[model samples]
Target: MSVLYHAVRTPVRWAFRLLTDLRVEGLHHVPSGGPFLLLPNHQSILDPLLIQSICPRKIHSMTKSTQFTQPAFRVVLAGLGAFPVRRYRVDPQTVRVLLRLLDEGQGVCVYPEGERSWDGALQPFRRGTLRVALRAGVPIIPVGISGTYDLMPRWLKRPRPGAPVSLRFGEPMCLGAIRDRSTRDRRLPEFERQLVREISRLASVPISRETRERLDAGSASPSGEGGS
Candidate 1:
């Protein structure tokens, strides 16, 4: 973490603490050291910042390439170690940058949804996002953020103060070559389901106990375990 990044984060963190009743759970699940991929469900634009505020370590997440066009924010975001990604398409440079960051032992946050959900429902993981984690060979920590959507949905101009929000981190998933299957293509669907299931469980949303249990059992399989 850079001095500038900490300096800036301090005030922003304080503001969030005051504005929202924020609580973090399962923080110990986050590894204290080494490169790890953070997969969070995207609910609002505030998702990344809210996650960063409570995290013990600094996070370097991929921002849309267009966000860097602003002259001022570019410098600030750069200091925070954010990299640019061209959304809705595969950009090799962005892939290389993410892989390199992971190899260098820096924490990186990527929303598997690729974009914030409009209906406040969990979205599917982008296939590319899963592939990157697998290629990087790092533990993936699934983050479930609740209540931010009501506080500031896409149509809102500003956040509503005093709303409650919670961030829950789940156990690290390590999806090694499943059952000696040498091909990633075969494992992709199961991998995606496992990631989504973890996020849903962590979110604690309303779902039948039987359904939840089934998803849990499906995802917990050691052979197809998903931390990719």
Candidate 2:
């Protein structure tokens, strides 16, 4: 990890834990060190930061290009190893950067949904996301982040802290060799759909029974403790 990563990570972890009842599971699914794609559901802007906070390795993320407009913010993002990608457009440079990072044995994060969900539900995976993973021939780790949608929904002016949140990482999946092109067009959508199903399932699963118990206890408190 870079010095800047460690510097920001400590505070990000502490803030989430203090602001909300945060729980993470399936962390062991991520390899200790490797080149792979980190795919996560996007609910709020917090999704990327949350993912980076818990990951043990330095993660390079493809952030929206507009975020880089500010000189100060751009510097901070660059220091943290983030690159910009123009959304809803074909940006070959972005893809090349991502593939190069993966080839260099570094992890990169991408939101397959292309954009955050407005309704706190899983959005359909955007086309071509899986193609990137397949081309790189790297294991793809699916991460599901729940509760952030309610905590910091798009409509909210700011996050309503104290909400319970969970982040779960699913097992690494390798998209075996691509079959010959005789029927690839028909098979490509199937591959993306299956991956989407796995991500959606992970999103719905709670962090654990223990987290539910904690939430139950808090709600059952005499003072009526509850998420904000």
Candidate 3:
């Protein structure tokens, strides 16, 4: 961890916890070392900070490219080891960077739901995210963050605080090396369903109707979460 990460982590975590009654579970599922991916849902803008505080491993997060355009915020984001990614369309460079980090045995976090939910429900994930995990061939941990939306949702300009929050890390999921194009295409939906199920279980939240429909339709929408 960088000196800045160490310097501000404790204070940020302490304040965040105090504000939201933050708690974590299934932390043992987080590997002590080596590369892994932390896949979580997006709720509040604070979700990344909350997850980073609770996660035992040092995590590099994926931030929206627009957020990086701001000089001041960009500096803070870079200091905290976050990288920018274009959310609306496919970005091959983002995939390359994520793979590089995993190949180097560093932990990375990506909110599978490309954006925060307007109604605090789970959104459909980008299919490419699953592909990345399968290609990296490392432990993929699904994280469930509850109560952030209530405290500070995307629409909420300020945090209300006092809402209880929890981070639940699911057991490591391994898709192995999915090299065959035909087989991967045929079974991608099944893998996606498995991840969605795990995330719902850990979070104790109902999957949105959109998620249900999207899964059944077997489509990867352009706005689906992953790089955002």
The lDDT for every candidate, in the order shown, is: 0.76, 0.76, 0.82
Ranking by TM-score: 3, 1, 2
Candidate 1 off by > 4 Å: 177-182, 205-228
Candidate 2: where is the Cα deviation over 4 Å?
177-186, 205-228
Per-residue alpha-carbon lDDT of candidate 3 for residues 124-212, written as tens digits (9 for 90 to 100): 88777776666677889999888998999899899998999888999998777666655666667777888888888887778999999
Model 1 scores what on Cα lDDT? 0.76
Candidate 2 lDDT, tens digit per residue, 45-125? 888888888888888988888999999999999888889988756777788888889879999998877777777767655
Error of 3 at 128 (Å): 1.7
Off by over 4 Å in 3: 220-228
Q: Which model scores highest in lDDT?
A: 3
